[model samples]
Each structure stands twice: as structure tokens, then as C-alpha cells.
Target: MGITHRGTTRRVRAALSAAVVICAVTAAVPAAATAAANATDAVRGPTVAVGGLDVGVERISVATDEGYGAASITPDGRSVVFRSLKDVAGSGGNEVYVHDRSAGRTRTEPIVEGWTPAISGDGRQVAATTPAQGMSTQRIRQHSLDLGILPFGCGRCNEPSLSADGRHLAFGVVDYISHNRRVLVADRDGGYQTIAYLGSGAPARPSISGDGRHVAYQDRAYQKEGVYLWDRTTGTTSGPLEGPDTYASLVQLSDDGGKVVYLSGSDTYVHDVASGTTQRVPDVKGVAIDPTGRHLLYAPHGTGGPSLVLRDLRTGTDKTVSDQPATAEVDSVSADGRDVVFQSAADGIVPGDTNGKPDVFVRRLF
Candidate 1:
């Protein structure tokens, strides 16, 4: 399951300007640690050699804590934003971090005790779950494209997912009296919230499009249990496109929200929203799709072991991206289908990964 709710008593530093916070945090990190984090020799060349296999992979997270997850990458693959509990000097708790591949630097965001961060395609805006001021309720916070920190007033909202342009934010909010959790899409600048799903049971986390027009979610209600797509243009909800079995989960929509990739039982399938056709992708576990919805990143099963695979939907071709057969799982994929990020417990993915904990790694498909 995704990060549903995270309430913290840590301080919220929303008053500080983004420039001052960034400069202060960047200067606080020790030079030696910064150098060690950016020493990504395994990710520069065409192919990274791992146990005699060629795979261009680099482990990005160097945190000592083992709770790193919910990663998002820019469309250009230049920056990666994720939530980390790494202990920074004089900092309180977990915070959001952005790792720039070109600049070879990682810096913390201004949010305090943030969780489940999602970045926009341009790598400018970021949204995450943070504590409400003076309250234990978890609220959504956004570092908008204009460099201003914005907060949503929903006292019980979490698991924020953003559109590629960062203009729309999708998340789950719970009603206080009815105790029902529904998916909501809100405008970043318009101060409007639209309910995407309002049925009985709890809906799955929503996946939005670049223009915030389409939202894909799964309904857990017994009568209408399947994946669904909500279109804001028509102001209507499409369907619970029947899965193979009763259990269906892990729904992910492309940047255009025209296609959806999800898991049913042990198999993976991609559903075209317009045609209402579902195709079961054999020998792979589909996780995410690129902006165009043509390239899919999955983990092929029935092979030797689990490894990252990038499959082109149009050509029916597959490229194995992970070099070693460790405990790796695909997370997010870049827009151009060239960069992929994942997490694994195995070592040797990069040099100096001696923390003995699961770490996030990026693979370039070039």
C-alpha cells in the first residue's frame, strides 16, 4: 500500500523563503559527504558492468535509514525527488530531497517531516504529505513552480500524486463523520477541489495526467470492483474495467492518462481508456509507463530472477536494464523512457553501498 497517513509533531518551516532554505541546506551538508553522494562512476557510460553483465545503474540514496521510498524523477532525468529519513546535522526528522544528476548534488527541501513526495515533469514543483500546523492531522504541501510553498486545508489528506505539469494534485481525503476515503483532484493555483471518486468503499490512490484532465483509480466496492478512469472534461467517471480476478491493485496511469497499467493476481495488464480494451502483458510485472504511454518499465518473471525491463509497447521489444539479478523492483520511469529508478537490497549496484539497507537506484537506458 502507498503512504496513507503520516502525522508528525515536527516543526513546519513554511515561512522561510525557498531561496534561503535551499542555500542554507546546501551549505550545511559536509563537503566529503556531498562528494561521496555524487560519486556515481557506475552510471556515466553506455553500460555498467555488473558480474559480467552490462547495465547502466547507479544507487542514488546514501541514507543510513532503511525507510526510503516514493521516488519521482523528472522527464529529462536530470533530477530525482524522494523522501528520506537521513539524519542531517541540526535538522529535526525526515524531509524531502532532490538529487540533481548533472550538478552532482543532493539538497533537502524546506518541508519538515515530509513523506511521499511527487515531482513534476519540469522538476520545479513538488507535493508531499506533511503535518498540519499545531495539529496531528496530515495535510498536503506543495513547493509550486513559482517557488512558493502552498498548503491544502484538507485535514485528512495524504498520498499526493501530481500531474506532469504540476498544475493538478491528486490525493485521498477522509471524511470525518462517514469515515469514507475518496480521491480528490485540486488545482494548484485555482483553489478548487473536485472529487474524482465518491462511491462507497475506499478507492485506490489516483494517477493523474499532464493536463489534469484524466484520473485513474481502482474502486474497492464489492459490486463495482475494478479499475476506473475519471475525466474532468466530461465531468464523468468511466468504468471498473473488469480484471481477471477479484483482487486488483497497483494502478498507474501514463502522463496523458490515456493508458493504465495495473496488477491482477500475479499477472500484469495494461488497459486503454478510450477503447476499453485490456491486454495482459505476459512474463512481466508492469509498474509504470512513460509520458507517451508507449514505453513501459516492468520486471519480467519466468526468467532467471527479478530484473528491470523496459518494454516498448508499439514494437513488442524488451530491454533488460538491471545488470545483476538482485532484489530489485521498478518504481518510476522518466518521460523519454531513458531513465528508470528502483530500489533493491543487494549490494554492488554502486561503490560504497555498505549501509546494508535497501537503497534507491537509477538506470539510464541510453
Candidate 2:
């Protein structure tokens, strides 16, 4: 979380812990999609120190270059995918890069400008959104970099998320004028089918379970902008899953799609879809749960900036993974919950983080 000063950028993080958060209702729109247009064409930029940020407790590992952002780890935790302005630099272009932890090598995606990348289950495929020709909207792409085939299929797509197997893609496409949105799902090959439309609900982003059978998203309707789940097999949608009257956003789903982890206000809760039980997480915000719905990675919405916390569902005990002065942007957790990756401007989380910018790091829960 770097804030731009007069001309330079410095790490300054901010977040609010809501004592009571209400739904924005139909007015709740998805966060604006990642902007990838070439904003700087000629001006030269400062050089960033790229490597050697990894040093600390063996469990904590730095995943990308010093200035890299928008990172995601593979299910196996072998590799990481991220976006950075360094690839395009002053030209304002964006470049996607993959870092292989075992090999200590970084490879840039051949694509000209790309952002918002997610990995598949096997750690073999990647799903990202690159700008379309006219650049009105971002299009979805699936591939393995230089190998095999990476196809650019959906145009006007927003925040594309990949299924565990990497076989399916789920994202949003909004109408330019009315801003009406639709959640769409499609196979890797192409041909998208609408999963849910806006009327009773305005979904921000949709996530597919590891099994790729259920789709979960935040329903942003007027009455109650809560969480909703969709079944591809039955072609039906259900939820707002009866817990709090406040707004609910889907944060994590079990591999079996039976348990859902969501945020109702600044508090996190786990909802059992079948048993109709909801467990309020003691105190946390912006959580990510493992596919089993047992392990959770969250940020405490208390005091000042919150540290990333990990909790075990069976034991119900919480451990603070990164207690830093700056605060962390809690991202995604590994399927087994052993690895939790996030972006942070916090120093001492690792050595050599002097770039004064937020970089991605993973904390091994073991």
C-alpha cells in the first residue's frame, strides 16, 4: 500500500475497523478492474532492486521482485505469479512475471501488458487479464507462458479467477453504460455461459471452488448485499446464507463447496451451507480459508493496522504470522493452508525490503 506524495511514492498503509458495517445495497459495485493502459510512454523511472529479499525465519519467503504487486501462489507453493510496472517501466506498459522458488529464476510472460494473475491447482497453468485491442475492457488469458497454448478469450472481462484444476474461468463483464454486471463461467477452450445476472444482486467478484462446481460471490442488492452461491450442476443460486443482516462478501469456500467463509461487516464468519450453522471468527477481517474450510488466514480489524493471523478450525486458536508496524494486505492461502501469501510494506518481515514499496511474501503455517 504505497501512497503517492508530491511526485514519489512511499509506503503508507491505512484501513478502518468497522464496529458496524451495513450493506451498500444495489449501489455496491465491484471495485474498478485493474487498469493496464500505458500511462507513461516516455518518462524514465527509478530502478528497483530486484532480488535477494528472502531472509528470515525459514517459514517466511519473499515471492517476487521488490516492487511487484498483485501476486498469487500456486496450489503446490512451488511458484508465484505477479504483475509489475517495472517490465514496462516509464512506458506505462505492464508485464507479468513468474518466479520459480526452487530454481531461483524469474521468467517474464511474453504478453505486452498484463495484470491480476491466478494459478491453477497443479501449478501448471495461469489465468490473467490482458487489455483487449481497443482497450475498453480487459480480456482473459490462460496459458503456461512460452509452452503449450495461452488463449485470449473473453473481452470486457473483470478480475478473472481460476478454478483449482485451471480448467474453468469465472469473472465479471459489465455493461459500459448502465454498469449492469454479469458473472460468467467458461472452459479453458472458450464459450462462456452466464452463471448469474444482476437484479436482485450485484456481484463484485465470483470465485469457483477447487472442484469447480460451485461459484461464490458477494451479492450487492438493495435489500441485503450479502453472499451468494451458485450451482453449475443444478443451474440454481442460493444465499445471503442467513447469518447477519449486514453486508456479506464471499472470501473463501471449501473444496467440497459445503462450507463458506465470508465477511459480514468487518467481522469474519464461517457458514455451513448444509447444517445451517454460522461461526463468528473471534476477531478478524479480509480472510482467506483453505479448501477444507478448517484453516483461515485473516487480518485483525482492531487497534492500528492489523497483522495477518492464522487460525485452526479444529483448535480455534489464532496465531499472528506477521506482526509489523506497517500492516499486511492478506491475500490467498494454499489449498492445505500451509502457505499464506500477501503484499506488505512492512520492513523486517524479510531482509532487503528497502525499496520502500509493498512486495509479496508467503508465510508457511507449519
Q: How does each model score on lDDT?
A: 0.64, 0.58
lDDT of 2 at 32: 28
lDDT by residue (74-175, candidate 1, tens digit) is: 767877887665644454446677777776666566665455577776676667777665443667767533344664566777777776666777778766
1-366 per-residue lDDT for model 2 (tens digits): 111111121121212121211111111111221122221111111222336333222212233344656666666666667666465644334667655555544555545345467666555566666666674556665555334235444457666666766666677777666667778776644355676666532445677777778777776767646677777666666666534555667776666576777876557888776666678885577556766677777777766754777788779787666777323321366666666666666665655556676666666655
Please list the residue runs of candidate 2 whose C-alpha ends up more than 4 Å from where it truly belongs after superposition.
1-66, 85-93, 112-115, 133-135, 146-149, 200-203, 304-306, 325-331
- TM values, all candidates: 0.77, 0.74
Candidate 1: segments with Cα more than 4 A from true spot? 1-55, 62-67, 85-93, 112-115, 132-136, 144-148, 197-203, 301-303, 323-331
Query: Where does candidate 2 clash, by residue pair?
Result: none
lDDT agreement of model 1 with the native: 0.64
Task: Give me the displacement of residue 252 in model 1, in angstroms.
Answer: 0.8
